[model samples]
Structure formats: C-alpha cells, structure tokens
Target: MSMQQFAGGNERFIRRYEYDDSWVIAADVGLDEDDIDVDIVGSTAIIVADTGERVTETEFELPSAGDASIDIHNGVLTITIQK
Candidate 1:
C-alpha cells in the first residue's frame, strides 16, 4: 500500500493497495459522499470532490477488468475494484 498527496494544499490524500485479483483505493479528504463523484473508464479512475470553495480532482489507474464500488464513511472515501 502507498499513500501520496497531490501538489496542492487541499489536504487530499490517496492511498492505493493491490491484491491478487483486485485493487483498493482510499482517499482521505474532508468531504461527504454527496460532495464527491467517481468515474471509471477502461483502466483509469477519476475522483472529484467539491467542498465549498475547494474542488479537488484525482486520477489513477486500476485493473483492466471488473467493476468498481465507492463509498464514503467518516470522511474517508473508499474505492474497491473487484475482478
């Protein structure tokens, strides 16, 4: 697992973990589920969060197959891709 922060002071953190047949991504940002949007196409995943005057975006690569599920709980956005 690895965690990285983008080049901004938006407090956006992205963590990625890889399993045998799946990939998991956890984002730590101070936003609710209703303020976030997720889009996955091909092997790329895009996440966007709108919080007041701050709008943050993150893009990363995922596995080629399967579907992705996203949920936000306690300010943590969890994305899971299953194959």
Candidate 2:
C-alpha cells in the first residue's frame, strides 16, 4: 500500500486492513450509498464519492487485483477486495 493519508484532493479519513485473500478499506466520508463509486484496476483500488457539499476521489494500491464489495452505513464507507 502507498500509505497515503488521503487521496488527491480528498477530504476524509481512511483506514485499511489486510487479510489472507483481500484488503478492506474503510472511509468516513459522510456519504450515502447511492453517491459512491468503487473500482479495482490491477493492484489499485479507486473510490469516488460525490455529495452535494463535497466530492472525493481516492485510490490506493492493493496486494493484487480483486473483486470488491462496497457498502455504506451511518456515513462510513466500507470496501472489501477479494483476490
């Protein structure tokens, strides 16, 4: 992982966890479920969130390419990447 505090021009807090088969990321961006987008390209995970007040784009390197599952709860964004 790049260990970036935040993605370019992003205004939020992010945390990352590693597992045997995947990486999980959690972001506190205060966004709704319908206002976020996630993708995995090669070894990178990209997250984009757009709300009326703020728009955020974040990315981090993963161990490898994997599938992603995303959900938002109480304004926290959680993403799990399965290798």
Candidate 3:
C-alpha cells in the first residue's frame, strides 16, 4: 500500500492510500465524530469537519465502487472504502 499526503484547504493535509480491495483515506484535522461529517456517493468520498468556528472539507475519489466507513481515532480521521 502507498500513501500520499496533499495540502488541503485551510492549511490542512489529507492522506490517501490504495490497496488491492480497498481505498484508505485519512486526515489530521483535530476533530471528533460529532464534529466531522462524511458523505460517500458513487466513487467519491467527501469529508467535512467543523473546527470550532471554521469548517474544513476534503474530497477523495476511489478506484471502484464499494462500501464506505469512517472512523476518528487519536486525532486522525480515517475513511475506508471496501469492495
């Protein structure tokens, strides 16, 4: 698996990874489950976080269609797309 971190809006960085049967995406936006919102449509995943008074959003495209899951642990927001 390979991961790449790209500079995102509002000075945040989003990380993406590709696996054989899944795609993993993560970010360190310092938000919790109550503060974060995740939306998956078709092959696209959208992650948004409400950091106090500021909002940050990130978008990712998957290689194929799959079930999507989100987890926020230890300050990292992880999204997994499984086929």
In TM-score terms, which candidate is top? Answer: 3
- For residues 9-81, what per-residue lDDT tens digits would candidate 2 score against the true structure? 4456777777777777787877777888877777777888788678877777765666777788988887787
Q: Which prediction has more favorable TM-score, 1 or 3? A: 3
Q: Total clashing residue pairs per candidate?
A: 0, 0, 0
TM-score-wise, the better of 2 and 3 is 3
Model 1, 1-83: lDDT tens per residue? 44444433555667777777677877786678888898887778788878878887877776564688888898887878886
RMSD of 1: 3.2
Which 10 residues in a row give candidate 3 its minimum summed lDDT? 56-65
lDDT of 1: 0.75
The best-first sequence of candidates by lDDT reads: 3, 1, 2
Scored against the true structure, residue 51 in model 1 reaches a CA lDDT of 84
Candidate 1: regions farther than 4 A off: 1-11, 63-65
Distance from true location, Cα of 36 in model 1, Å = 0.9
Candidate 2 C-alpha error for residue 74, in Å: 1.7
Scored by lDDT, model 3 comes in at 0.79
